[model samples]
Structure formats: structure tokens, C-alpha cells
Target: MYRYNDFDEAFVRERVAQFSGQVARRIDGSLTEEEFRPLRLMNGLYLQLHAYMLRVAIPYGTLSSRQMDQLAHIAETYDRGYGHFTTRQNIQYNWPKLPDVPAILSDLADVQMHAIQTSGNTIRNVTADHFAGASADEVADPRPIAELIRQWSTDHPEFQFLPRKFKIAVSGAEADRAVVRAHDIGLVLRERAGTLGAEIIVGGGLGRTPMVGKTLKDFVPLQDLLPYLEATVSVWNLLGRRDNKYKARIKITVHEHGIEEIRARVEERFAQVKPAFGGIDMEMLSEIEAHFAPPAFVTKPVDAYTRAHEADPVFRAWADTNLAAHKAEGYAIVTVSLKKPGQTPGDASADQMRALAQIARDFAHDELRISHEQNVILPHVHKSDLPAIHAALKAADLATANIGLVSDIIACPGMDYCALATARSIPVAQGIATRFNELKLEHEIGPLKIKISGCINACGHHHVGHIGILGLDRAGVENYQITLGGDGTETTVIGERTGPGFAYDEIVPAIERLIAAYLELRTGPEETFLQTYRRLGMDPFKTALYPEKDAKAGKEKAHAA
Candidate 1:
């Protein structure tokens, strides 16, 4: 939770005033839709299929309870009753009126938040591990570096308009919760010989062309990160394609020119820019680090927590699924699930947001985090507070014990909201979650990630799900394609597609068949779907998906042989 200084306060207020005038001009016909597109996009406003959507950045996914309350207020007053949390750890208000955007932004500014750089073909929100300071296995908190990058990149003269939007993710933990491999620039903090630095991974992205980022620099000292990043983005900004918007991303640039050449160019540019950074970045990072110091953890008995776990099966189930080990002795990290059965994957109602805020204030350390998995996190909840927190969440309908389960899916706002989508995604996700819940096999099925995207944009990150579902329009009918064995972790891999697409009506049953096949093929109940898929490969799942075709092909191959 980095608090805004005097300069930050003035800067954001100035930008709000600037955008307010821009908005007025658009409404007054001084600026047409064509003219206002870039300006509005720069402010994180989008004209969606039905209404305008505003994406507000949650830097490093950290928020104070006060800030959370402000967001809830914005949702209740300006937009609809709920807000959608995105895969980037940002939040979207889908029903804001054109005239009310400035007011909404003003409210955000009051809370030291803004929508700048959340959209546009510039460096979007700099994301980090949601459990940055609270996780037990972290080398160090990555938020200070993330904040430094944010301050440096916001309104940088050289990078205001790149060839395409760029993303950067940082993770400090041994486990890759941030999915850094799928970003344009992924930084994994590492310590060698008692000194901290980062391992840089470049060119990773997912869309029509999915790639796991290749290692660019094995280790870069913390002090030199900014200069090195400047080198990387400057090289791509100039070399990336401008002719076709589709191929304008830095990922495409890295694909065309190998990593070696890119490294050479970046090194050449690094020498030129390294002098300008002359320790100011380090000074600022030091200042930013102070704002992120860990909360004073209180020592408390866990007798109540143990009793609740032993006595109440419901509380125990929720705790087992939703809780993670914290760095502090008595504290635990709690993930508040937004993917309740049949609801949108990442949406939180205004009341739910308020409830979470109150719970954070009372039971937690007044801190909240938005995980990239589309869930809210109370990162410093004492174990003794678990029973009360669980009761409050249950009252708000936020007590779903499905974290990392089959029903806890990640899906994008497809044809329902996005204009670029070719088919519907929300309904498909709802159908899948509801179907699995009805079957009561989610816990039995074990940990699984099912990501869905309405199109090739891969906003839902389907390319990295254990079971990836991509919805497309096949001859005006909705069709879904499946990819298996995709993972977004330290050992990241793009999913492999199973043969053909299934009709919308057939997609859920097709998923069921795949799961059934996995259960049968696994060595035992402990072997998860992903493990079975990796051990046995896609042939079995494909055969399950297209039984008649697989059998016919097998007979044809036998006859030919």
C-alpha cells in the first residue's frame, strides 16, 4: 500500500482535470468518436458491446480496506451493482454512463487510485505476486520494484505509444502464482550469494501465437533493473511491427528476430540509457520499499480455529480449499472466491465488496489483495479469526470452497460484453461450473484449472489452463475447442489442442468425457487430471471426445497397415 505523496496527489488531480475536459469535448461534439477513441482509451474507458467499461488499475494487486470501500461505493453509485476483477488483477465497471466517468475517476483519485495506463497500447498495469509480502516462501516482496516500475513508466515520454500494449509481471516466490511466463516481460526475483536480483524472461505471451518466454538475462542486479527494462522496451518499441495491429506485439518482434539478436540490441541500448538512470531509480525504490513493510503480526492462540476445523465440516472444507500458509506464525492467507457456482467468474457485487472490506478491517490487517486468479485475498488473517470470517463471508455468499477446483474456472466477458468476441464465454463458464457442482464431483476431481476465452485473444488465459476451452463461431454456430496439459507455472507450457471443435451443446459433455477418461486412466485418485494427461498424452482424451471418429480411424489405420 504505497501512499500518494504531494506530487502524486497533484499529478493525479491534474490528469483528472485534463480527462474531464476531454470527456466534455467528446460529448459536446468538439471531438467525434473517431477522434475520442485514443483519448478515452488512454483514460481506460472502452465502448463495449452494450455500454462503456472502465478498468481501474490495482497496482501489484494491493489495496487498503479504505480503498476497497471506495471501489464498492463507485460500483454502487456509478456502474451496476457489481464489478468484474480481471486476470491482470484489475477491476472493470461495465455499465458506467458516458457523463459519469469523470465523477467516477475523481472518486478514485480521492483514494489515490487511477485508470491511467490500465488500457491503451502502452505499458499496462505492472502486476506482481498477490501474496507478495505474506507468502511463506518469498525471497523478498516484489511490490517495491513493481511500484518503482509503475512510477517510471507512467507517462514516460519515450513509451507513451508503443507498437502494441505491453505487460510485465514479477514474482518473488518459488511457486509462480503470478503467471510471469505469459507476460511480455517476466521478472522472477532470485538471490545468489546473499544479494537480490531478478531473472528476466522475454517474449512470452498468449493469443493466436502462444509462447513461453525465453530467458533473456539469468540474473540482473536489483539496481540495474530499470535500465535493463528501458533497454528491452526501447528496442521493441522501434523494431516491433506497425503495419499490422495483429502482429504489433513485442512477442511477434521477438519471434521474428531471435532472442540473441534482441539481447544484443537491448545491450547496445542499455549502455546508452544506463548513464541517465544514475541512482535516482535506486533512491526511489528505497523510498517505495518503506511503504510495503510487513504488518506487525500479533501472537494469538489457534484454539478456536482448531475447534472449528474439527467440529464444522463446512468451515473445514472452506478453510482447506481457500486458505494458504502465511509468512507469519499465526496468520493465514484467505482467498475469497468470486466464482460461486453459476455466477460470472471474476465479478464481486457491491455488497460483497463492502463485506470483504469490513472483514479485512476487523479480522485481517486492513489489507486486501486481488489475485491474478480472479479472487480477493485477505493476506494477513490470523488463524483464530477464521471461524468469524468464514461466517461473515457465508452470509455474503462468498464462502465457496472451490479454490483451484474444477468449478473455480477463469473465463472472460465474451459476446456478453466484449465487442471483439465471436461467441459467448460467461454462459459456457457458468454451464461448466454449475454442471460440475450438480454432479458433486469437484472435490473428488481434485485441483484443476479450466480457462475459457470467447476468441483467440486469450483474455481468459485458456492457453495455460489444464483444460483450455476456446469458443469460436463455426459457420454462425458457437463451437468450442479444447486444449490439454497447459500450465502457467515455473515449468510453463502451452496447451496442446485435441482434434476437433465441439458444438456448444456438446462442449460440457465433452469436458465430462475428458474428465471421466482421466479418472479411468489415472494410476490412482491422487493422480490429478493434468498429471494423467501428461503421463498418458492427448490420445486418450481425444478418443474420449471423439469416440466414433477415433474408432473409425483406428480401423482404417489397421486396414491400411
Candidate 2:
């Protein structure tokens, strides 16, 4: 965890002061809703369907126990005693009063946190693999460079406003846990010529026109990274479309102007700006790396964990699903599932938040991570602490043995909260999870991702789920559309949409039918939904969803491919 320096502290405090005045002016009738919209968005405040929502940035999803405690405090003291962790690895307060926002921000600033750049047409929070520092397979922790980009982009006058919101994700592992391919800018850290460099990926995004990022540069030396990024954003800033908001993202720009031409322009810009970055970022990177040094580990006997797994079926199930390999010996990374059945996905109550904070402080290092999947991660929990941690989480109703399973669905706060939403997403997600839970077919179904979005904004990343569900309003009725074989990992691909949409009542049954069809059509229990879909293509899934349209255009395309 990087502590804030004087400059950092002064920066947050100044922003808080600035926003406080903005809020005051808006309240006192000096500014109208129209006038304050951009100002509020800049401060991470959104007037949602029901109430104002405040999104706070958790840089690279890392948080100290003390900072977690403060978040817990905010949830309890203000709002509704709960907070929603988002796919961006940020947290949103659904009901913060207008007057109290500044105070809440001040509290966040006290812990060296803020909501700056979490919204609006600016570089939002730079995200990375939640398992970055702790993953055994990582080439290096990506936080140092993620922090470097954060520092560089924060209020960088040149990029204060872009045609659309820009996102950057970095992953240090061969496995793309950060959904790097779906970001506006993706960086994969790898060794080139005996030195750590990055593979820069550009113009990948999901919204209306989803695209897997294209490689901009195969290998950018660590020192040249800042300059390369400078060129990338500069090129996009100048050439990206401003005529239509829908065609504003760099992904569309890259598509319209071929990637080769864009690459050429970026190279030209790189030649000019590369001279200005005289290793200042490299020095800063070194300082940032020191703060992320690994925590000291004591080799603990795994006898207790082995015994628990051998004796307790429930404990074994949770451990198998929720645990990942840690870099240190005798330790495992624990993913605290927020997708408990019948609960809102990615939401943790204040008590649950405090429980996790306490568990992190006592059992693991005083560190926690917010994963892009909207789960809390205890990144360095010793194996010996398994039973106790599980017990505590179980008591809190957080011990759901479904990390990548059906019940662990990803969904957005749709019409239930988001004003931009045409249909309700949470209800649809709840319906699917509850249906599967009642059927008791989740674990048997194997690893599956069901992502739902209220609209085509793709806030829930429906385009990348193994089973993607998009909610839409059709002629005053709620309709749900489905897509198959979408994935967000290294083998990234946009899902194929099944022909036709189902009514709200028909959506849940539609999903059930799809899953049932998969079970019968799959090679065996060993074949996962995505694996089966990929191996056989969309023919079977489409037949399952739309038998009448089986030999239609979708089938033709599937058959042709």
C-alpha cells in the first residue's frame, strides 16, 4: 500500500475544497442541474434513478485495512449501511446526501483516497490484476506502473477531457485476470531481451462496438513506456471523433482509421514527445515499487488446512472455489464472494465490510484487494488461517462456494438505480441465480460467467460473459437478449447474439433452458459451458435458445465459420 506524500495529501485536500465549493454553489441555486452535471461527474457524483451515487476510486483495487475501516465507517455513518463494489474495482454509495458529499470526500481524503477521475470523459482509475503482487505466476507486481500512470493522468491538463471516458488496465501475469483486452489501453508485462517490458494494446472496448484490443507495440522498454503512452493518448485525443458521442471511443477511431495508420501517427507523435520524458517517471516508478514490497511470511504448516479440507465438505468446497495460488509458500489468496444467493451482486453491508477488514488485519497482511469481478480478496492469507477465516465469513453469510460458478453472476445496477437504464438488471440476475440455486445445478454445471447489463452501455460487461444477458425495453415491455461464447480472458472474443429477445418473464426460463440444453449437449461434466460453446461453436446454444431460428442467419454464420 502506497502512503500519500505531502504532494498527494495536498492534492486531494485541494480537490476536496474545490468540489465542496462546487457542491455549495449547486445547492445555493448558483448552478442548475444542467450546469452542475459535468462538475458533479468530475467529482464522481451521479444523479441516478433514485438518488445521487458517489463512486470512489480504489487504485489497482488495493486498500489498507485502515482505509477499509474508513469505507466501512462511511457506509455505516452515511448512506444505507452498504456499498456496491463495481466491475471497475471501485465502490459506489447509492444514497449520499448532496450536502454531505464534501464531508464524505474529506473523510476519504483523510485516508488518502478520493473519487477523482472515477467518472466523466477523463482517464478513469487505472486498474490492474487484483492478484498482481501476490499471484505466483506474475512477472512482477503491476501496481508500481499502474500508480505511475495514475500520477501522470491525474489532472493532466492535456487529457482533462476526451471524446469519451478512457480506461487502462495492466496485467503482469500470462493469464489476463484484469480483462486487459477489453480496455481502451491494455499493458501486458513480459520479459524482452532480459529486461521487463510491456506489450501495449490499444483501442479495445465493449459498449456498442466491442473489440479485443489490437497490439500497438510488441515490446516497449520499461523506460519508454511513459512516452509511448503519452503518444497513444495524444493521438487519440487529437484524431478521435467528437461529432458523435457513440463513435467517440478510441476503439471506433481505430476501426474507422485502420490500426496501421493510427500506429503510424502514434509513432510520429512518439518521436516528438519521447524526448520530454527524461526518466522522471522511471525514478517515480522506483519509489512506488518500494511501497509494494511483499509482506514477510512465516512458513506455516498446512496440516490444519489439509485437515479441514479432508473433514469438512463445506469448507473444502469454499476453499476449492474461492482460493487461488499465492506467491508465498503456505499461503493462499482468498476471494470473498459478494454474490451470495438472493443478494445484490458485489454489495457488502457495513458489518460484512468490517468483518473482512478485521480478517485481513488479523489473519492476512493488513491488505485487501477489490477484484474486477466485484469480490473482496485477502491476497496473502496463510493456509493455517483457512478455517477461522471461512468460519468468520460463513457467519457473515459471505461464504458462498461459487467464485466462477453460475450463482456468481456479474450485473449492473440497472433501472433499479441507473437512470440511463431502460430495464431492471438486478432482478434479472437475481432470477437467474435463484433459478439455478433451486435447481442445484451450479457446481455440476462447472465454471460459467453470466453477465447482465441494463442497456447496451455494457457496464456489467455482458459482451464478455460466457452467457451474456442484456436487458432492453421493447415497445413498453422489458425484453432480454442473450449471447453465447463470450470471454474476457486472454482468449478474448465478443459473444454471438442469439436471434430474438425474450420478455421479462421468459428470460429466467430461457436461461434455465439454455443451461439444461448445455448439460445434455456437452461431452461430459468435464466440459464447461464456455469450453463446450467454443468446441462446438454457437449451433447448439442457439438451438437451445431459438429452435425456430436454428437454421436462420445465426446458424448460417455458425455453420459457415
Candidate 3:
């Protein structure tokens, strides 16, 4: 995890002081809502449907046990008893009093955390794969680079007010767990010519216009990353559409002008600015890398773990699903599923948060990670500690034993909280998860990702799910549009929209039909929903989803006969 230095500490304290004054003014009626809107947004405070929500950034989704404890304390003291982890790997308190926001920010700063850039149209939190440094297939840890980017982008004069919110994700591993292709900018660390480099993907985003980012630079050398990134964002800042908020994302800009044009402009800017970023930036990167050195590990035998797995079915199931491949032989990356049945997806209670902190301290070298799918991870838990950790997590309701299962959904707070939402999303997600669990078919249906968004903003990343559901308003009622064959993995691709949208009541049933169609059409059990869908196409699922229309069409043909 990245530790805050004196500069970071001083900056946060100054900001807290500034915000404290702002809060006082607002409470005293000197600053109206309109006057204080931008100030509040910069501090990650939002006036939601019922109350003010405070979003705190977990930079690159890394946290220490102490930091986790601090978050738990905030959840218990400031707002409700729980905090909702988001797709961007940040946490949101859905109910914080307007006046208490500065206090909450102060509490966060105490643990070297803050809500800065968690909202607003600036560069939001730089996210990375949960299993970053520990993943078996990683070429390099991306967090150090992500942290460097965070430093560069934070309060950057040129980018503080962009056309719209910008997101950046980095993945060190080959598996692409961070959903890099769905972000505004994606960095995949790779090795070329015996040197570490990055594969830069630009303008990939999910919103009103979803796009799988184009490869801007196939391999950007480590020394040139910041300069190239600055150039890319600067180009977008200058040329990106600002006339309409809906079309302000870089995705729209890339779509309108094409990737070739965007790439050429970025390259031109990079060439012009490369000279300014010399040895000074390189030295700074080395300093940042030193801060991210791996913690010491104790070698331990895990033969007992193998025996325990053989003896316990529940442990075996959890081991199979919840644990990920780690670079270390005796260590594992454990994903704590936030999607427990009947609970809100991505939410962790204060007690649960504290329990996770304890687990990290006791078994995970005090290291924690937050996945892009809204789950917390103990990135370096020893295999021998799995059973005990699982037991503790179960008690805290943090152990759902469903890491990649269908019930593990990513959903944004829709009409329930977000003012920009056109329809409800969370309830629909909960309904789908419940229905699937009731059927006991989630396991049978392997590796299915269902993402729901309140609106076209794609905050929930609906466009990249194996099954994407986007909520909208149709005739004063909630409706959903479905997309198929979308993937947020190494082989990134944008999903194609299926025909018509379904009403709110019909959405879950439509998803069920689609899954059933996949089950029927799959070649074998090993074939996942996405593989089957890609193989068979949407025609079959389309017929099942709108069976009545298909049947009526058949009857019309018969009448013609």
C-alpha cells in the first residue's frame, strides 16, 4: 500500500481546513446550495435522494489494516453502519449529514485517506487489479505506477476541469482483472525486449456510447508513460466535447474523430512535451517504487491445507471460487465477496470492515485490496490460514463463497440515490441475484457477469458484462436494455445491443430466459455462458426473450398458408 508522505499529509490537512470553513459557511446559510455545489463535489460530498453521500478514494484499491479500521470507524460514527464499495474500488457512505462531511473527511485524513478526486470531472481514483503484485501471471506490479499517476493528476492545473470525469485503470497481470478496457485509459504492464513497458489503451469507456479502447501505443516504455499519458489527456482536454455533459467523455471524442486521429494527436503532443520530462521524473518514479516494496513473507508448509480441503466440502468450494492464483507458492489471493444473498451488493457493515482489518493483520501481512467488481481482497493470505479466515468471514457475513458466481453482481446506486438516474438499478440486481440463487443454478452457470447501470453513464459498467442491463425511463416507468457477448477481460470487446428493451417487471425474467437459452445451447458444462453466447449468437436468445412475439409471427405465417 502507498503511504502518505509529509507533502500528502500537509495537503490533506490544508484541504480539510478549507472544507471545514466551507461547511461552516454552508451551515450558517452564507453559502447557498448552488454556490457550494462545486466545492462540495471536489470534496466528494454529494446531496443524494435522501441524504449526503461521502465517497472516499482507496488509491489503486490498496489499504493497510489500520486504514481499514479507520474506514470502519467512519462507517460506525458518521453515517449508517455500512459502507458501499464501488466499481471504481472506492467506498461510499450513503447517509452522511451535510455538516458532518468535513469531520468525516478529517477522520479519513487521520488514516492517510481522503475523498479528494473521488468525485468531480477530474481524474478520479487510479484503480488497478486486486491481485496486482501477488498475481501469478503479472509482469510487474502496476500499483506503483498508478500511484505515480495519481500524484501527477491530482490537482493538475491542465486537467482539474476536464470535459467530464476521467478514469484510469492498470493491470499488472495477464488476466485483466481490473477491467482496464472499460476505463477512460487502460494500462497493461508488459515486458518487451527484456524491458518493462505498458500497453496503453485510450478512450475505452462504458456510458451512453460504449467503446472498447483502441491501442494508442502498443508498448510505451516505462520512462515515457507519464509524458504520453499527459499528452493523451491534454489532447482530449483541448478537443473533447464540452457543449453537452452526456457526450463529454473521451469515448465520445474517440468515436467521433476515430482512434487514428486521436492517436496521431497524442503522439504529436508527446513529441512536443517529451523533452521537459527528463531525469527528474525518472528519479521521482524510483522513489515511488521504493515505497511499494513487497512486505516480508514467512515460508510455511501447507500440506495441512490440502488435507483440510479434501476433508471439508465448504472449504473446498470456497478454495475453488474465492481464492485466486498467486505468484507465491504457499500464498493465495482471497477475494471477500460483498454479494451475499439478500444483502445489498458491494456493501460492508462497520463490524464486517473491522473484522476484515483484523483478518488482514493476522493472516494477510496487513495488506488488503479492493477489486473493480466491488469486492475486498486479502491479496496475500497464506494457504494454511484459509479455514480460520473463512470461519471469521462467515461470522461477519463476508463469506458468501461466491466470488465469480452469477450472484456476484456489480450495480450502481440508481434511482435509490443518484440524482442522474432515470430508473432503479439496485433492486433489479438484487431481484436477479435472488432469483438465480433460488434456482440453485448459479454454480451450474459458470463465470457469468451481470452488470447493471442506473442510466447510460455506465457507472455500473453495464456495457462490459457478459449480460448487460441498462435501466431507462419509458412512459414514466422503468425499462431495461440488454446487451450480450460483452467481456471485461484480456480479450476485450464491446457487447452488441440485443433488439428491444424490457419493462422493469420483465427484466429479470428476460435474463433468466437468456441464461436458460445458454444452458440449453452450450456444448458441454465446461463451456461458459459467454463462450456459448459467442458461439451461437443472439438469434436463439432473442427468440426466447420475446417468445410471444416469435410465436405470433409463426401464427401469422401459418395464417398466410
Candidate 4:
């Protein structure tokens, strides 16, 4: 909840004015589409299949209730009556007219939000653990560091045109809810021998080639992190491939150079830049931290929450799935499921957005968070407010009890909206969610992550899901490929592909079969899907996914015998 100072206000207003002129130039035929492309992208505008898409950065996924209302207003006034919360902890307005983007940005600037650095070959939105400040088990809130990076990277002259787009994520909690390992620079804040520091992981990314980052340093003192990070990116900015855009990411650079060489180069660079920082970065970080100071937590009786949990099975189910333990006693973190069955995974209607804003203002601490999993979070809700919050969510049709369950899928806007996508992701996600809901087996399945991407860009983070589905166009047909054993937590693992792709129609049943196999193969109900997959490995799931191949192998083995 870092409020913009006068500098930030002036900066954003100036950009809005600048972009308004650029937009006007394009409309008046002074700028062609090619001429406008980079300008628009610099401002977080994309030409999607149907129209321009504007991605607004929600820095570290934190939002004030007033800001949320502003977003709702933008969704209702400038574009469609909904916004798609993306895996990058940002929101995309997909059908905005080119002429309206500057106005939308102006509205965002008024609320201390913007689309700046949400796109283009510069640092994207700096993300952090969604539960950063409120999680029960974090060393400290990491959003201040995230904000520091955001400030440092926003139009930084040196990194403005890196080889390719860069990303960074920070995790404050023991659990890596931010998918830190999948980012270009992943920082896990930890206290080491009385000094707060970060375990810096570098080179992690997901796209056509996915990688779990390698640890570059065991610990970088909190004060030196800015310099260390600058060195790392600067090294890559020089060494990263420019001839091939696909190989330009830092992950590829690290892969080619080896972590040791990269580490050596980064250390050398850090030494030169370390002195130049001169405590300025630390001063800025200190100011940012003050802005993120914890909200005043109120303590009260929780009898209403207990009564609702004991009396209503519906509320109980929701509480079981949608709530997380809070750092403050008698408080719970409520995840409002945007992935309601049969709807687009992250699309929140304008009314639902306003509803969440109101609920945040009334029942919670007037704060909201957008998780990378495409859910909205009420981070500091007292237990006594549970029933009322649930009722409000229910009224807005935002009450779904599936958080980590199978129906709570993370899906990218595949060919449905993305121009780069070869196959559809939304319908497949819908089909799977609807199918599992119909079977009423989501709760029984227990703690499964199903991520779907329309293409190999891994926008849905399919590479890290417990069960990942990657949609591709094989020949002229839509083909769906499955990957199992993937995880995005602290112990991150890239999923392994399961043989040939299935047809579009065959994908849902394939997922169902895999779940069925898990239900039967599990040691007990206590063992979750991920635990079972880790213990038993991918053979059983692969057999379940491709029964015909498994049967053929079995037949050949029998004949040989």
C-alpha cells in the first residue's frame, strides 16, 4: 500500500500527457501502426486479436479499496464491464479502444496505479508473495523491497532496453506463493545470524524453455541487494544474446555461461557498483517500508465465525479452502475465488470488483491483494467478519470454495484473446472446472493445481502446476499436452511432459482419468496429489493420461515374456 509521493504523481501525469499526444498522433495518421507499436507497448498497450489490451500494474499485488473502486470504474467506463487478472499479478483490459487508453491511464494515475513497465523490454511488474505482510510465517514483509525495485527499474536508463523483458519476484514467507523460482530474479528474504538478507536465485524463467532458477548467492545483505541485483542484470544485459530473441532471457544466458561464471561476473560488477549506492537505495527502502507498515489490527470475539463454521456446511467448505492463517490472531486471509466454475478463470465483472472494494472497506482492513493464482485476497479480515464477508461474496457470485482444489484452475487467455496463442485455454479450463464440479469430486481430490497455457509462453505458469496442460496447434488441429509433477512452491519443480498430445475434446477426460488414478493410487486421503506424485513419480499418472500407450507397452512386454 505504498502511496505515491509528489514525484510519482508528477511522473505519471507527465507520462499520461505524453501518451495522450502519441495516441492522438496515431489517430491522425501522423504515426503508422509500426511507428505506434513500441510507443504503445511502452505504455502497457497490446494489439490483441480483437482489440488493444491494456495491462495495468498492481505493484506487488497490493490495492487499496479506493484504488480497487477506480479499477472497477475503468472496467465499466473505458472497456468491457470486466477485467482479467493475469498471472503476472497485473490486470488486463482486453477490449479497450486505442483512443481511450490515455484516459484509462489517467484514471489509474489518480489512484496511484499505472500501466507503466507492465510490458515492453524492461522490468515488468515487480511481484512478491501475495501473503507478504499478513502471512503467519514470513521473516518480514517483502513488498518494500519489491517497491524499491519498482522505483529503481521504472525507466532506469541503463536497463530500459535490455536484451529482453525482465522479471523479479520476492518471497517473504517460508512458502513460495509468489512462484519466485520461476522469475528472472527471485529473492527470498531471510534473517541470517541477526542480519536480514536474501537468498538470491537467478536465471529462472518459463516460456518455450523453462528453468528453476539457480541460487547465485547464499545471502546478500538487505542493504546490498539493490547493488547486487543491479550487477546481476547488468552482467546479463551485456552477455545475454541479442541475435536470437528466444535466447535473450537471463535464464538462457545463465544456462549457457553456467551459474559459477555468472556469479563471478555479478560479484565483480557488484564490487564496482556497491560503493556508488552510498546508502541512497537504503534510504529509499526505509521510506518505502514505512508506507507498508502493518494496518492497525482490531481484536474481538470470533463467535460469529465459529457459529457459521459449525452451522453452515457451505461456509465451512469455503472456510476450509479459501482461508489462510494470518500473522495476527483472530484474523484470516480470505481468497475470493475468481475461478468460479464455468467462467473465465480470472475475469472479474465490474460489479464484482466494486463488491470486493466495498467488502474490503467494511469488513476487512480496506486492503486487497491480487494473487498470481488469479484470486482476490482480503488480507486482514477478523474471524468475526467471516460470515458477513462470505454473504457479500455470495451475493456477488464470487463465493467459490475451491482454492487449491482442482476446479480453482489458473488459465491464460489463449487463442480466445491472445494473438500469439495457437490453441484455446479458456474453454479447456472451463470444461475441466465444470466437469470436476459436476462430479462433485474437487474437495475429495485435495490440493491439486491445474494450470493451462494457450501457448509455450507459459503465461498460465503451466510449467509449475501440479498438473499442467499446454495447448498447441498440431498441424491444423488443436492439441493439448499434459505435464505432471510440476510445483511452484518453495521447492519448485518443472513438470515433465506426458508423451503425445491429446485432442481438444479428449483433454478434459484425460485430466479426469489422471485424477481418478490419483484417487485410487494415493496412500490415503491424507496424502495430497503433489505428495503422492512426488512419492510415486510420474509413471502412474502418465499411464493414466495415455492408457493406450501404457496398454501397448504392456502388450509388448507380455509378448516378449
lDDT of 1 at 302: 97
- TM-score of each prediction: 0.98, 0.97, 0.98, 0.99
Q: Write the per-residue lDDT of candidate 1 for residues 1-561, one digit (tens) a residue.
A: 799999999999999999999999999999999999999999999999999999999999999999999999999999888999999999999999999999999999999999999999999999999989999999999999999999999999999999999999999988999999999999999999998999999999999889999899999999899999999999999999999998998888898999999999999999999999999999999999999888888997999999999999999999999999998998899999999999999999999999999999998889999988899999999999999999999999999999999989999999999988988899999999999999999998999999999999999999999999999998999999999999998989999999789998999999999898887899988999889988888888888999989789899999999
User: What lDDT score is found at residue 95 in candidate 3?
Assistant: 93
Name the 10 consecutive residues with the lowest summed lDDT in model 2.
546-555
Distance (Å) between predicted and true CA of 370, model 4?
0.2
Candidate 4 lDDT, 1-561, residue by residue in tens = 798999999999999999999999999999999999999999999999999999999999999999999999999999879999999899999999988888899899889888998889999999999988999998989999999999999999999899999999999878899999999999999998899999999999999999999999989999899999999999999999999999999999999999999999999999999999999999999999899989899879999999999999999999999999999999999999999999999999999999999999998879999999999999999999999999999999999999999989999999999999989999999999999999999988889999999998999999999999999999989999999989999899999998899999999999999999999999999999989999998888888888888789999999999
Pick out the ten consecutive residues of candidate 4 with the lowest summed lDDT. Answer: 541-550
- Report lDDT (CA) for all predictions: 0.94, 0.93, 0.90, 0.94
Per-residue lDDT, model 3, residue 419, is 86
Clashes of each: 0, 0, 0, 0
Q: Give RMSD (Å) of candidate 4 vs. truth.
A: 1.1
Q: Give candidate 1's whole-model lDDT.
A: 0.94
Poorly placed runs, candidate 4 (over 4 Å): 553-561
How well does candidate 3 match the true structure in TM-score terms? 0.98
